[model samples]
Target chain A: MFTDCSSSTTSRLIHLYNRNGVFLPRPSVSQFSLRTTASTWRCTLSIRSSSSPSAIVIDGKAEAKKIRDDIKIEVSRMKESIGVVPAEDSSEEEVLKYVSGFNDDPSVHGVLVQLPLPSHMDEQNILNAVSIEKDVDGFHPLNIGRLAMRGREPLFVPCTPKGCIELLHRYNIEFKGKRAVVIGRSNIVGMPAALLLQKEDATVSIIHSRTMNPEELTRQADILISAVGKPNMVRGSWIKPGAVLIDVGIKPVEDPSAAGGERLVGDICYVEASKIASAITPVPGGVGPMTIAMLISNTLTSAKRIHNFQ
Target chain B: MFTDCSSSTTSRLIHLYNRNGVFLPRPSVSQFSLRTTASTWRCTLSIRSSSSPSAIVIDGKAEAKKIRDDIKIEVSRMKESIGVVPAEDSSEEEVLKYVSGFNDDPSVHGVLVQLPLPSHMDEQNILNAVSIEKDVDGFHPLNIGRLAMRGREPLFVPCTPKGCIELLHRYNIEFKGKRAVVIGRSNIVGMPAALLLQKEDATVSIIHSRTMNPEELTRQADILISAVGKPNMVRGSWIKPGAVLIDVGIKPVEDPSAAGGERLVGDICYVEASKIASAITPVPGGVGPMTIAMLISNTLTSAKRIHNFQ
Candidate 1:
């Protein structure tokens, strides 16, 4: 079927691996829209035919705001129809109790136990308590596992990584045959980001502290995503010219000029990288806003899945 | 602390990534009967300091036999003391009923539903029914998720990949700083195998059907693991001379002279690869035996975990 499609003008097959690792022909475009880029082109793994000479800065703040607005509308609609008032939360147990309630409630689309719970609380246990069906954050191990897999659809993707990918999608960054390097491997960002890149058909490599010649690896990447919270760890020399850089790292460094006595910085030397790279995200505006926006998106998606909404 | 161990004769720390991907110094050396060759020679990421002039065939058969004997003894003792009998099964519900029973049973430590269940049943759903603590196969999504992430430990590593790593361990093959390539990304073998390699500080790359110029990727590996079922797909030229190869793929190719009208083969061209490669696993005697051994080992570990065995 893919060969048949590949020959036609409707060549919409994105490369995908099956559960068996067999290269089967599955169409990229689908009715259910659960379709991922599924292709069986072993011999001819070509880059995207379309060319975008340059990348544009993705407006994560505006994009996130729109999603939040959409979710707000949905929440209001639920409130009017079902008398669903938002649950109150302050303490750990209270938060967990509410999450448990939402887990059972058909009206509740998503459950989020915001991080930095009381020091005494066990975060893993509490987070695990969220029903996987409503795990919009996609922090659950099963969800993470599904996300890491080639052919599996995670119920939800971690908002930060999802947002990172979403930004690329919105900006039309082609990763199909690119060499991508992720600086860190954090479950929240780096690891999931690597998985996301692989899903889009990029040859991905994950570099860590143990990695030797990290700059050499970074320089080889056409797309570089750095999530390590080390301010300016990635120098301009480490980046490949014309590479698409997505900096997820947000660090606080002492800054006398800033009113707060500290300023936010990223893993990559953004000032230098912006000059060197073709497209890059800033420390404050790039990924920060997208995280919340993705949360809203995931919540909306969960609601749709839970309620069987079109 | 690994730093303490690094100062002495004992320097074994497996390259590990955490759930958050924070590089945690987890000691891989265990008092357990089954211990992997976990080492901490970050400075000495060099290929095996001690040389095997020729590729040594890892005797997975003898190793498996030893493990099986130990498990058999443990099982016999379990049977005698607890009077635990094997559960009966046929239908999906019945099988699930037994699995749920094992989940609750104080005596039953591990649960394994042999593959290729009834056509009417859902395999993934039935497998999910098994308690993760007793999922000896390590096929649970949580386990797999943990395996994929850094800073998290899966209760059980999938057998074939574990065996592949164990062989390297037994042979003193060093992977740190080595570019390792995986030829496929199946859940059972390739994907987990790549993770295991990454855990051991190997710079890993996965080549799939969508991979363009796979030979280029394979040639870059100091360690290559091939799990694609296609027999003799990997040739001598694809190998890096002195590179270590683990052939996870076992295909039963048609052979008129063979007794069963078929002969077992691996993904790599053994005749060619053995000559070019430094170390390699043979088809029939390699990963196949280790898989069963790992199940027994997992069952024992589960029993220890369940019964509070010291």
Candidate 2:
């Protein structure tokens, strides 16, 4: 179970979960079939392996639902709906005005601006305009700066990266003293993920386009996270025996057998990695759902902090 | 040869410096004797080596002076004095008020609050109050956030980390694809230095107190930076032969023969590391001076940026 808890709370919960021996086993592939929807692409987890796969399949969809359920209980207990202000298709100035309005509104707890603004708009400027307190997306420079600093905590962490760590915590994965390698250095997923892992006491190495001998470094990782958005860039050979894998890359690839004639694939070649990795997150059902779960969690958190609610 | 230059400009300068074959040699211990004064501690560089030191001594003090000279020329050309407002021994609210005043002041280019504020003062809150445009100290979370993000530039890089990188640039040390290890995770130095090294395209690993086998990881570094302030903590066995070492740690230890009844030392054991490493920085004269130089450089850059002075 997951809560919109701080690091200390999360650590305590992790210990409680471990002491109770409540480790959730990899659900059978059949269990996932019932959960598939049009929004979530259909893919057979067992089919990814050429032979009987030894690795545990991390059911991120299930984990995300559990988190949402926990959040739902918390929200209902608060007995108040948190307001989120979203402005769409507006000029930069117009969006800034809307953000300003939300900043002053006592009822509005969070404000999020959609990314990849119009070519004429300055994205950074628009993002910077949001009040840091209402920056639930955690893209604000101040929040990120605090996240990067030791002995400091950001008001919010980027939802996607927070979700990735949440999955690890829920699964009782040990991060301390681990050799962790992050593939890609993107601001959204890779960079923040690396920072979060480092904060968790893992020795982290970040590999990007300029990195030499990436395979050599990847082979040393006890845990590996790939977020380069490249399909099948990481091969099974790159995996160290029994390494935990978190695949954040999701790309639609040609697949005639699929319902939509296309299917989602991750950075890791899942067919091969499942045999070697001790645990792995699948493409569509993994980090994708967790991102949404964390956004909702952040909004709830923002509301609580704003009202000074316990 | 050092300028208050952007990364691109520094890269170009490094290329030019490398092509000209003008790398400065380690100054004789006697040359340093004349430069020492009451403010600066007197320490012999070669004396750290029990035998003839094969490693090149990175003369950070000399390089810092060169940087200051460049800034001096730039300041004269600007023909304007950049006003810096410093607040001391103020309550949190008082410091915030001063910061707000400086933020509104047109002539003020920078606002710096000396660290380790009174116990009643919230340091992060005070630091965050500074305007991002005038945060020459780069302690502002916004600046740090921008620094951590890819394809984004911070208004200012933190002085100590910036100084560390500047020394590497001036000495024409290659960063791309190298395995860089940073010891410590302090906000002011270790964390930012690791981020800067990663930005330079070095596959970087950060080792902190919780690291299980720091020596094992340090041995893999082609470039190692030790910022943990424990004196002589990093031994020769921890260093990889031919690696470059940057010691940011400065701790005064007991030395009866020294002038003040004590002398400064770095995290690394200079006597042992000099034999194994290709180059190393001496504590008293290394990162300390470069920090001051970067502060002056940042101030000048802020002024130029505020005035649109090329």
Candidate 3:
């Protein structure tokens, strides 16, 4: 699901137990310890290919990388124009640094932290700790609440959901007065995605796993989206002919023949769905890039507001 | 729709203006005319009745009033025991009086401001002004954002959505691994409702007006909940035979021959849906009351936390 990267330094581990009247565990390599060396370690998890025929690829991975590149460029521009810079560190210290740095900076606008962060971190606590003014991800409770309630607009929208709407807009898909079915109920994707689609004047319905007969329900959708992580769960027969399908699931299943012993897949069976659906996104390229692109967009928006930039 | 409570009390108008400066035209409405006496005003809207009916009443209005009465009683008991009162000031004078009267009293743990304030008001700024600790409605952006993100729970939840789940729980509706369809995408009822349904381990999908064929999609729901405000928009044929229907729409349609010249209705066509569906919630008395009751529950929970009485 993710690439693991490790870089090592020559600095020795500091065991500061009982320092400043605080008792803490000593820094020692144990069974649970992460292996490290002076250089760097990078491993790309490959997806397994199914025996099934070829399917349409929704390339989210490539899109996410492109967005990251874009952000890197904009970040450089900010540093060039002013002394201000977005956090280079992805730690709590980096969060604090940006929080205090953006206090009065006229050059920085929005701030964002990538989602699906490491399991040890609490997303809300970290989001709350970030300056609300720069919370470009809109994952903060305040932003979400504002998005949910009327009369308040979110400073930032969750990236995946934003990407979903953006795709519809890009593809010139008509949503007004049309019946839409959104599969999955994740807050970051399904919930906000439905809200955005509804805002666009679509009569929206949310269908989840609890739905008794999903295939029957999905067959009615003119526009269908699946964000749940179950690979190949939505079949071609599930979609109505000429229906627009957006698959948000990205997973790696085992494949012994592939280069990496695995291959990527989407929530919908791209092969079968593409034949029946009018428009479908490819796995790996479709929605993957939009999240980070939206992140950059949100960050720039936040920075613009903070700096009062035209 | 809302009633016109316009009055001739200049001072009172001024008071409202001062209290909600964000939405009011002027910081002080002392310069405008106001009504000195309160008058009865009612909603004016109508919906077509079903030819033959079968839906059971969900009864939101009765439930809300009952919950309010319970709150009033509890408020009295709290005041008698701890010499503190909940904030109820809608005017400058009352605000001053309450602030002075409750100086530093920590006994009042939760403060909830009932929603749907007069049309001449700013809901967002007013709700924002509530103390974070006493924001029982969870309408605040901070609270909403937390609710949207994974692993972050809001201290409070919006009342109606909570009530919907409460009914499901009370009735022992099996939600786990079931497919649920939630119609509408409103902030209060639709968006949060989908999230709550998903949190209960059901696969969820959201549909709205843009949906091309809602009837076809709806027939697949094991559980169907409609929060769309349209009167009797959902028909009997649109539902699955055994699907559970939770209608959140409460509209008062024009009924010239009826008492008060109006009749209450729901999003679903009651009679037809009830006959076709296994169970359905009626308008007026259904989800409406649960909102207020949940508000009370949130308040009590907040109070217990504040007083360490739980």
Candidate 4:
């Protein structure tokens, strides 16, 4: 998880804080605190995979790589067609350049950034900085605020949640009047996922850590999407038979039994839940692949709009 | 509702989006096919109160007045004690000044803006502009974001929801492990209120317009908070007898039989809900008073903090 991006920026601040007691205010520092303190170090990140083990891998990493390659090809094509350029510098700069270019190009339909960016970056600020026209991920506060309000539609949705809904759409899962429970409320995944589910006309309820008796509520869900990063936090007892389960959690678990003494798992106990639920997504290959696929879709849409392709 | 504040020298941006075609984008004109024919016209401003015999008066006008008076007294005292010049302009101005002042003054603690601001103004922009420190309403995005995350507390709770919870707290209602359903996910009321209930260890569910089978979920609520602006949206049949109800809506309903053509009403059918509910707040006298009282409390806290008072 410590990508090359993490070392260059926040390491400077950490070095300063260690050497000198005076900690200067950097927006990056607060984000770093949120990342290091909240997700990785404080809790167990992984668990065992499937006990039954018929599950297919989602392969988010491979999917993301495929999407990035497609985007690079499209960017070059746009240049060939109209002399427009996609930035080769920072992802933020590249996103801004495409969004800013939207004023002149009505054809450019989408713009998106890959998620799990370096923790030091302000996600919301960077997302909002994307011009509204090219906001393929639709993570901007304006888009989020619009999505939250009645009678408004976000131009684009965050990739992971969008992928979840697309899965339902592709599988022809009926959402109308269905009781749905979203077990997270992050701006990136759970919140938008719930909104999309509601847009599909499902009766949605959000249960977070503060929610008491989450299992009871989950047991009632005909459709459940769990994005709480906690590994195997959801038990088999929580599944409502015939319910469609989408597990978005991907945790790295340490186990001597597995390769390299570690393995990936999801929020739900796959063995038990799969037995009861009608359909369920596996940790590494299910929701993960869809996320990257949607990212590619969003980027292609953006490029099409930029090139004015009908 | 707008009022002249007791403060001075508060700079504010009064945004005007003319409904009379001042800034309708060119594309919208093309869609309407009235680009040349469109002409500006001054629209009549009216506060069209509702018309319902069973209306419950919310009394925002009285509540806001009382709050302002209380703030006036505190501002007078601060002047006497610290010689800090308190600004007086308008309701919007007062909120801005206090928020801006609170940002600089280490002593200031809490700040709030009275709700039902003039319809001409942009509510979200104004609310978002309030410094998070003094956001007593807790409507600011940053504060709301923090509240949504686990292990976080807002600087101040939204007064309306806080008042609703205070009623539950005072009445010895047990929400812990109890299922609570909040209708409406507005940033100011519903969303934050659900978060607050969850923080109290209640199993909380939020239902908005997009929710399907809202009535079915309402039946599951041991505690219900309805802030859906629709008057009498939550019927008695929807409520579970003995369930505690907090009606946060206060809409004016016009009645030719009454002295004025209009009177206040809540989102719940008060007569029906009161009969079924173990306890219920009267629209005019219950949550209304508590909200204003909390605002005063927040303002006093701000002043004390500015003065470094323990």
Best by DockQ: 2
lDDT of 3 at A22: 33
Please write out the lDDT profile of model 3 over residues B223-291, one tens digit for every residue: 888887655567666788878899987766555456996666677766557767766676776787787
- Reference interface contacts recovered per candidate: 0.43, 0.82, 0.82, 0.28
Ranking according to TM-score, highest score first: 2, 1, 3, 4
Query: Model 1, range B42-149, lDDT digits (tens) per residue?
Result: 221111223333666666787788778977888777768776523223677876886798799977756765454658778998888987766767766678788888
What candidate 1 gets wrong by more than 4 Å, as runs, is: A1-55, A69-98, A104-110, A114-136, A257-261, A303-309, B1-54, B76-100, B104-110, B114-136, B254-262
Q: In lDDT terms, which candidate is top?
A: 2
Give the TM-scores of the predictions, in the order they appear: 0.71, 0.74, 0.66, 0.60
| Candidate 3 segments whose C-alpha is farther than 4 A from its true place | A1-98, A103-110, A113-135, A149-151, A203-212, B1-110, B114-135, B177-183, B201-209, B222-224, B228-230, B254-257
lDDT values of the candidates? 0.68, 0.73, 0.63, 0.62
Docking class of 1: acceptable
Better of 2 and 3 by TM-score: 2
Clashes (candidate 3): 99
- Between prediction 2 and prediction 3, which has the larger DockQ? 2
Candidate 2 or 4, higher lDDT?
Answer: 2
Best by TM-score: 2
Per-candidate Cα RMSD to the true structure, in Å, reads 18.1, 15.4, 14.7, 15.5
